[model samples]
Target chain A: MYLVADINVEICAAKSCKLCTQYCPEANTILYSDEMGKDQGFKYGSAYVAVDRCKGCAQCVWVCDNMAKNNAIKMIMIDQLPKAALTDNITYGEKSTTAVLASPVVG
Target chain B: MSLDYVKFSNGFEKFMPKEYRDMVEHGPFGKKVSVSQVGSFKEVLEEHPMCAGCAMTLFIRLAMVAFPNPEDTITVGTAGCGRLAISQAAIPFVYGNYGDQNGVASGLSRGLRLRFGDKPKDVVVMAGDGGTADIGFQQVLHSWFRKERFTTIMLDNEVYGNTGGQESGMTNRGAVLKMAPLGKKFEKMDMVQMAKVAGCAYVATVVPNNPRRVESVIKKAVLIAREVGSTYIQAYTSCNIEYAIPTDKVMEDAKAVENDRYQFTEYVSEEAKQYLTERYGYKEFLAKPAAAIPNKA
Candidate 1:
């Protein structure tokens, strides 16, 4: 689940900024909603992004309008089974690399 | 008055003259006073392409000021002179791109790895709205997919040209592009969101005009990119020339347009203005914010 500051857990204020909103290819993320949760009233609404749909491209955050300090939507792998590799050094580009956030130990 | 004299007096007052002698005539409290930062209006535009009015300058304002030793160290190109633009004369070693920014960027990314061997150097590929949205998009993607160490910056100017002034994919819906037959109604593609879904991490969107957050955001973006891996920096870039606007007028317009359109009201509620003052700095208001914003969520 995403950790949002107020009631509207996923909406970014820059949704109105037009920087990232106008350019986003998938119109999936709903940053604003009416059933306003806690402090996240009408001003802030969020969309539930489909994990399968996410390309891991970082566009929703890129297309944000408000320049919010905190990230509203974050991706996390839920329900992982045991027996995954403990140490996986995935090199994305040619030079840089990042360790997987979590990996299970393999026998 | 010769340009030389104007510059000489101005230079002397700042560097050598005493406070009383250096102080130029201050206009009456309410009257408008224009102080030219560059030699002339046109020259300023030509020289400082990145500094001109647009949505992205807000971010540029933050990035350019705080990015120390970019020249001689961090080598960047395009984004219509962004880091590369501001540093042309002031900071040296920034490469210039004629076209094919992405292809060139890929080569640079590859070459840096070979040369530095993961030692770490800032390799910035600055792309303007047209350049990235149209021309450089392919190369940038390849680099991103490969997970290059270089940071690719997109300045969303929203219109095509080095000529013609056609609308690119990044233009806002219904905003008038000079070449648009029906005034550009199609929605813009979300590059930042796309970048995130593409697997790019360390994503962040910033408006340089806010001054409050732009600098911190810029530093954070760059630092994050350096640490986590390749970062795709997309920011709002303003276009005053195509819109046929004055500088200060465009700055004011940027503040209003961006402020009005602000959605996601939950995260940034207290009027971006107040947030800017408290967190970033007052000078951010000195110019317009960036045009493109990255989705970090």
Candidate 2:
């Protein structure tokens, strides 16, 4: 059984800082996107974790909290995550799932 | 005539480095490729249930990249932390008895050779230190003694991770584990030297921090096995949860140990080294002191 870990990109200071990737022992487990905040002036990349591959090691959470000082990544119970985030047909090598939480975005 | 260029879809791109992105586009990352690229080939092992940040997971991924042919390769697994990848791995995998990993691989090697003499498939074993060094030591030794043509990759996490982090033969002295509450009394088992004494044609020890180096060594080990004989690649991984080491500092500790205690060594028989140099122009093989990873704790 795997736990669900999501990344909050809205408040995330996505600047291509690959602390999670650097710290993640699994390859391609945490992917980054630079296009999200390009218009907002910062060039840091938005990070997303591969839920299927995530073993709930929480290294991403550790890096985000301790190293980056941004509590952008949260580890949630698999059942608590939205039904849409969990998919049976996880096409390997495709980063299809976006780990947005169920809580309403506060704008 | 002017051509109309359509915009790509929203989900087409993920967070990937430019170098990796370019390679994935051609055929490796899921596209149809006539040939598989070591760096970008679709991972056969997917969603293993091992602990997140488990070093074995990373080692499997790196080894996959170094694999000569994922399509034709047959992966053999034994009991331990390495078993996590068996079900999810893309290639055809066989789960052997804990103490019979080498025996299974040896039989598979011979069976493949009998069926297709010149085109025998590659057989690779993913085993933990406990399975490789302690329980299955005799079978592994006999396989190397007889020169079985298979690659055995040992993911040495120092302790028996699956069985609640008990001290294994590979556990170093002075480290306190559940089995060794008062700290281990014996020094770590030298599997590298054991492989050499057992007549392994190719051998190397590496860590997960250096992906490129891991890829290079695994690729070399696989090549040597196919052309020469049996090869053993032992990778020093860490059991973060079991070892009481923080998850974030796992790689740091692995690097520190490699730099401070054990110097990473690569061994190749004289004949194989000559063959590699002559055929592949491979001259960059050396054993040197590695820089230590900073210890935060």
Candidate 3:
């Protein structure tokens, strides 16, 4: 339902806290193994989050502080996270499963 | 809006300009203007060199009292001198609007004690009602316990004068003003009580009914803190502007404060008289002329 990056950042963007591996609605994302990067002269992971098929839902970003701060992952087309854009004081559950809203036509 | 005072939030919000010109850049002190001329009046500071105004005077005085070497000493407060700590006469300083200056003063004093290590008494904290009473109360309380040898001045005008007339923790009972239009119903807090219960080593309350007394109380507070260490002074100041009262009548209100002169009954120990006389020189301190803001610093 949603895409998560396979890599992680070494530092959280705003408070500079520890980084968690890529979190997605499906919870398939994991750490890229390398904490320290030679290019940036610090510990960091690549940001490869694909939020296109995200079903306009946000679960992965809640767990990732870097994503919240720098917005490394953004909606490609449909609807961007308007509510999340205004506030960032939330946390995510361990399971990053994408939640599907029950559309009236579904049942 | 017809009051003789103006809000001190800088150049941006230009809600009231005429009041700003008369009260701030050109002040009520040392000026001779009739009540009718408030709207058209512009402050033409007399030929004599001025010490800016209250916040400026407060900051400058703090530097003289705290930093001995003229090189050290930082100040902190909110709005006017509190927020924008401007340097005058080569003195290093800091300022901010209402909040705990305790942390800033504590850090600076501790730093001076640790790095300079030799000078822990070089920082002065000057705060207003909103900062000292609302936010910075915790910090100042902790600093009192920390026993750092820095002095803190709580300028009590009762309301949060800088923030568009909000009710502050210090607002007096029945004092009808903005924000608390029905008049502040809650009991006004006694900061001296806070200091006493929290183990503040020294405590004093001085008013400008007699400016000499104010300077004396201030000087004595600084001296005692410097000598024995750790103290606070709640300087009871009246904000004629904040209350939308005429500035010309401020002196009358100041004199009236003598009637309500702080009753240090609760916290004052048996040795209060000796302490007042020896420390603040309270009796003599009270003798200074009403208009005399001692230019000691």
Candidate 4:
């Protein structure tokens, strides 16, 4: 699986548009979170990847780079992620998670 | 060979992926040539920092492959996204200030002529639409006016992509950009006509999708520029980021021009033609299926 390790919040339009999430083939691989919105001083939200289940397909990255025309998402090699990679963010569904997370949404 | 190895490979197959194999088998510009006859000895450039699937990368690669001699060739780049990506080019490159590429090429041409004398040395200027049509327009005109013996190529992506999609003189009239929120006010500059008026020996507009035409034209341009005078080749490149499209759609967008609005133009001076015929035995220099390249605005 690939990791969306760095989301350049500044480059992202940050309109909480869920194109990336909607385009992902895997379920729950990308989850919309309000934390990124807080970081960008927006009340809406932004998309976060569940790196473990990402599968590195880069569909989300393609969506962000092409459809959205925002270079926010970067599909990084899993081996390149730091040891504390998934420890810094609150992932979706989980009551408590940090940094990054991913899952495929069925339906 | 072992039976297992025989099953895995064909004698001619290089065992590379289909795309790499195609590039190798069909030659760099999609033509068949022996390994020894390939234009450049080695791929001078292997990597770039341009946006993934940038059209400029394709044009640059084709230019490198079309060059007859890489050892004696020097590329000068001016500011813009094209220049940004050329930083890692395998060939030697000089980073000229925006619009100063022609001036740099002029000086280089003179110096190379003085040093090499009879030996051929190519000095190619790689610049963007903004550098050619706007920022560096005057210097380019002056260089052409002086008939500098060098080839100047403009990778015209329409918009000033590197500067956050600003409107450039080459940008389409109705195209909206950060600087032209409502669309650009003026029509795009007719650089071909301008070049003709400026006394350029050869001028051609090409699209990167047509590798054969690109290779033929650039090689001809380099030769004509050396034997005759200045040559200008403006390649219609698409800016996926600025155009807000998928990177893979750049070629589609570039090809769509043939159907409507945009048309290609190629012009060669009599002097250049005579030089080609005399030096290279090119009987017909003007006839290259002109329909494939539109001549009108």
Candidate 5:
């Protein structure tokens, strides 16, 4: 199981608070992408969980629920998510258009 | 060791947990990070199982960010709501028995000093109001009196939040709770005054309303504790559940409390003032306005 942003991206508060992205243990697991926001009809970008990189620590969920007071994230079984969302080459907003970067494995 | 263990072996890096690897590379272990740079970096604290909108957890998170030398820092925590988030931090934590945090930290800081011998190894005791002002009052006072080289932080929620809501010494007078059926008879214990009287070199009281100020206070306290005598910081981290504060209104309630009772106050001894001025070149660290509370609304 891994964590996912299951709530409406409009109320994510990723651009302002970004507590989940700040506290997540894994790097690149949660990223704020402007392109992702545009796709979701949000003016400012919203945070999304890269399922392949997420360790299911639920740090994002906790921060969203408690710190940001926005219930925008949740944990779900890996099989419950579609296979398309579970990609090793998870691209970020504008940066992904140039290069497809794989999740960082080491420091 | 000398922060060498934070790195993983060349071939074995892939096998390591992403959290551990990320901490080694991007975590604020040996770097200088302020509260403003919070979201851009990986924090030492991770996901916690504490209550939603827990002010104590938020305080703990900000405190973790303020450690001057997180790689060499060791925190001691007692059994309370504070520990639920403290023990989850990336830094090594010593979870002592009920109200034994000060006692444990006294020995731990001494041991670290002997072993490191001038190398900075900060020992911080973070506990709830019941643990500091009530259950471990003796140890806390004695440790300060003995001038142990460490920092003691009281997460004062004004009530015993962990083992059901009970009236603690820090609880304000006329506040009705479980044990105090007819409202508390006495005023809240003035631990801030007691800490000053007990020979703490640096003492301060703050609320977690402003993250930057909280960061500055904690960093200054930890730095002072390293060179000066004992230091103390009391943070008013209200309990949302016990106090019946709405999850969304936690920060608002804290702001209200800060304005009414827990105004930001700092008491730096002459020795500490001189040390800070000379060492860090901070000439006006103590000249904060009486009402420094920012109107962030």
Candidate 6:
């Protein structure tokens, strides 16, 4: 499990209030990307989660939902994700995807 | 070991978790950082399982930032909501039995003092209202009366938040809750005044509405307790869940409560005042009106 940032509704107040980035226990798991916000046409930068580094603590989700009141981040179960959905704008999922694909489920 | 132990080596850096690496490199462990730099730097607190919009969690975060020497400081807490976030911090923490934080801290501070021998290992006792005022009242008072060289901080959320919204001694009079359905018959214990009378060199009552003020008061208390007698800080960290306060209105409620009764107040003994003024040049604390003088025969 990992976290994904919804750039549309998660209009992050990146520099002004980076609560998720500051409070996340793991380092470099959450980063403020000016380019990501610019690509999404947001006036301010937004935060993105590094899927490979994220421990799925859901701390960022709590901070975003309660403290920031933005409700922009959500936890995604890697097994439930469709194969094609991995190529979407949820950046930094390639590593997790390859690892998951390398080990096929033997039910 | 020296502070170098907290830093990572060049060759084995990759083997270390990025959390520890960031804490060593960008955290406020040994460096001088303020609350304003919170977002720009790495915080000592990690992801906690406390309730959403928990005021106690927020205060714990600020207290971590206020530690003058995080690398050398050891926090002691009891069974309460405050410990959930406190134990998550990167610093070493001792979670004592119910309401035994003051007892544990007395021994821990003395042991650290003997081991370090003026190296400055700050031992802080952080507990909830029930832990400090009700369950551990005797230990807390004796620790102050004995002049144990440690700082005691009470996270006053008014009620027993962790035990399902029961009433505590720190709960305000007439505040209805589970155990006190008819409302508390007595007024809240005046811990600040108690601390002053019990021989605490410094005492302060604060709320978490202003992060900077919280940091400053905590830093001062910890620093004073290092050399002076014991110090105390009672922070009003409201329990939004038990109190039925809306998450968004948490800060507003704190502000209202502070204005109504728990206004920010600080009391420093003459010795601590002289020490602070001489060492840190904090003369402004002395400018405040002194406590009323007692009658002498």
In the range B1-78, model 6's lDDT, one tens digit per residue, is 247767777788889865566667666666787765554466677766777667787788888888888888899999
Q: lDDT tens digits, residues B88-167, model 5?
A: 87788999988788999999999988898999899999999999999999999999999999999999999988888999
Error of 5 at B283 (Å): 3.9
CA lDDT of each prediction against the hidden true structure: 0.44, 0.69, 0.45, 0.67, 0.76, 0.75
Error of 3 at A75 (Å): 69
Write one digit per residue (lDDT tens) for candidate 2, span B1-297. Answer: 001111124675575533233333332322322111221223444555677677777778767656656656788888887787664655668899888989999999888888877764789988999899999999999999999989998989999889887899889888898767898889998888889998998899888766667877877777778768899999988888788777656666777888976567889898778767776678765445698989999
Where does model 2 sit among the CAPRI classes?
acceptable
- Candidate 5 ranges with C-alpha deviation above 4 Å: A1-107, B285-297
| lDDT (Cα, tens digit) per residue for candidate 1, span B31-146 | 22121110001011112334333445344433544342232135456545344344532222345454466566567656766776755445566667776666667766666677
Each candidate's interface RMSD: 19.5, 7.0, 30.5, 18.5, 7.1, 8.9
Model 5: colliding residue pairs: A66-B53
TM-score of each candidate structure, all chains considered together: 0.49, 0.72, 0.49, 0.63, 0.77, 0.75
Superposed Cα deviation of residue A71, candidate 4 (Å): 29
Ranking by DockQ: 2, 5, 6, 4, 1, 3
B-chain TM-score of model 3: 0.64
C-alpha positional error of residue B235 in candidate 2 after TM-score superposition, expressed in Å: 1.1
Predictions: Cα RMSD each: 24.1, 9.9, 25.2, 15.9, 7.4, 8.3
lDDT of 5 at B140: 97
User: Considering only chain B, what TM-score does candidate 5 achieve?
Assistant: 0.93
lDDT, model 1, position B245: 57
Report how far residue B244 has shifted in candidate 6, in Å. 0.9
- Order the candidates by TM-score, highest first: 5, 6, 2, 4, 1, 3
Badly placed stretches (over 4 Å) of model 2 are A1-23, A26-28, A32-47, A51-53, A60-107, B1-41, B278-297
Report the number of clashing residue pairs per model. 74, 9, 14, 21, 1, 0
Winner by TM-score: 5
Against the true structure, what is model 1's DockQ?
0.01
DockQ of each: 0.01, 0.23, 0.01, 0.02, 0.14, 0.08
- Model number with the top DockQ: 2
* Candidate 2 residue lDDT tens string, A37-83: 44456655355555555667776776678667878888777656553
